[model samples]
Target: MQIPVINRSRHALPEYQTAHAAGLDVRANLAAPVTLGPLQRALIPTGLFLEIPVGYEMQVRPRSGLAYKHGIGLVNSPGTIDADYRGELQVLLVNLSDQAFVVQDGERIAQLVVARHEVVAWQPVEALSETGRGAGGYGSTGSA
Candidate 1:
């Protein structure tokens, strides 16, 4: 699919991949750098402002290699960017490891997947349809 991407600065739109075999990484621009502390907290910045189309959203997710290597991850896994929002994308990162981490400019912080969704309007009802494991939540099923 041809997604319309805009670059306000001279920096290029985030490429999905390089010549490397791994998936492409999203990066911060030259202006911002995200810092992760031993406390496992980071303030991630959205390199560019986006205008996503309606019915679709951009999901911000962690890179597996980074997660495995550095123990750094997005605080809100699969963070959601609504279509109606035209703002900077900020990622809250948590460093699961014992050391500090730094996100450099043009470094891939996470992957963004543009996805389509259906919004449902809620209506109050007295009862809901039953399911196989009705109301059984929070590890109701055995963890093998």
Candidate 2:
């Protein structure tokens, strides 16, 4: 699928990949770094903006290295970017570490994955069918 990327500023670098076969990584600008306290929040901006097509959504996920090395991760992990959103691409990041974290400009704070979604319409039903373990949840089945 063809995705439209908008570079608002001339200095903004186009979306690039860290590894040839790895997913594409988005970077921040050169002005300032988005800061997050021990438990505070920050909106990290991606210089390169995108226009996602309908019936598709972009998932803003944490970079594995950043999350594993540092306790910083997305506030709403796997945040969704709708197709109709036309504003700047910002990542809602929360620092769960004990120390304050600084999201440096041009740092790979998050990763975007485009996926297709279906809008399922609900229909009124009179009654529901039963299953083997009806209404059983949370370890109702065997763990092993």
Candidate 3:
């Protein structure tokens, strides 16, 4: 599953930290530190461009350590990058804590997961097939 990528940042290419990890750790590429106040969000650049396959997509996800320790997370959790896009990968991050969080250069900020997708054609029908819980949504099943 090798994909073509251009690393324009100062950091090394993204890699899986663990053997069984599904996502690669993406780093931040910045000239200086960018601080985000409580509830403030910013688009942090990665300086990475990818030539993703036509049937594949890249997903930007949040690191659990950052979310649990510093209360920082991605605004668009699992931000999708279509295969056709050839732009810098920027992470939309928000400070969810009461303090300000500084984004340093070459800091690990997010995760990148490349996955294959299916292109479905318009199958216009009168109604969808019935199920045991048809139309059940938003906690309709049960509470945790």
Best candidate per TM-score, number? 3
Candidate 3, residues 1-144, lDDT tens digits: the string is: 888889999999999999999999999999999999999999999989988999999999999999999999999998999999999999999999999999999999999999899999998999999997788899977843
What lDDT tens digits, residue by residue, belong to model 1 across residues 100-131?
88887767778888888999999999999998
In angstroms, how far off is 50's CA in candidate 2?
1.7
TM per model? 0.81, 0.83, 0.95
Give me the runs in candidate 3 sitting further than 4 Å from their true place: none
Would you give me the overall lDDT of model 2? 0.76
Candidate 3 C-alpha RMSD relative to the actual structure: 1.6
**How do the residues 17-129 of candidate 2 rate in per-residue lDDT, one tens digit apiece?**
64552345666563776677798988866666778999999888887888888888888878988999988888788888888888786677777787899999998899889
What is the C-alpha local distance difference test score of each model? 0.75, 0.76, 0.94
Clashing pairs in model 1? 16-24
- Best lDDT among the predictions, by candidate number: 3
Q: After superposition, how far is residue 51 of candidate 3 from its true place, in Å?
A: 0.6
Error of 3 at 78 (Å): 0.4
- Looking at model 2, the pairs that clash are none
